[model samples]
Target: MAEDMNVSKGKLQRDLGLLDAVGIGVGAVIGAGIFVVTGVAAGVAGPAFLIGLLIAGFAATCNGLSLPN
Candidate 1:
């Protein structure tokens, strides 16, 4: 039954280390900062900022998709 299911019997490895954990935490903080800054920017710039934001998002999506997997 296990063979039919094709499940791996090998044990999973613990890969993440201290630096990886710290990097993840820093990324989360920066992500939150971006949101806060974006809100402030929208308030200051009004409707124009939203159009720029949409354009920036599309560019970012294109950049992300271009990266090698």
Candidate 2:
């Protein structure tokens, strides 16, 4: 597979192990999305995204606290 050029620099800077390499790649994509997707997310999810995120976070916390990790 071809290396993702976007992740190469971060992986190099982090002295990435295999797991870190995977994390670097996901981080690179997520960072780009945050930079590029504001307009799209706002248009699609509208003013409710913040509230939705909070609700989801609360649900996640409740589930985590209740469950065996």
lDDT by residue for model 1 (1-69), tens: 556656566744467999999999999999999999999999999999989999999999999889686
On a 0 to 100 scale, what is the lDDT of residue 4 in model 1?
65
Considering every candidate listed, which one attains the maximal lDDT?
Answer: 1
- Give Cα-based local distance difference scores for all models: 0.90, 0.78
Q: Cα RMSD to native, each candidate?
A: 5.8, 10.5
Candidate 2 error regions (>4 Å): 1-22, 34-39
**Which ten contiguous residues of candidate 1 have the minimum total lDDT?**
5-14
Specify the highest-TM-score model's number. Answer: 1
Return the lDDT, model 1, position 32.
100
In model 1, what lDDT does residue 7 have? 59
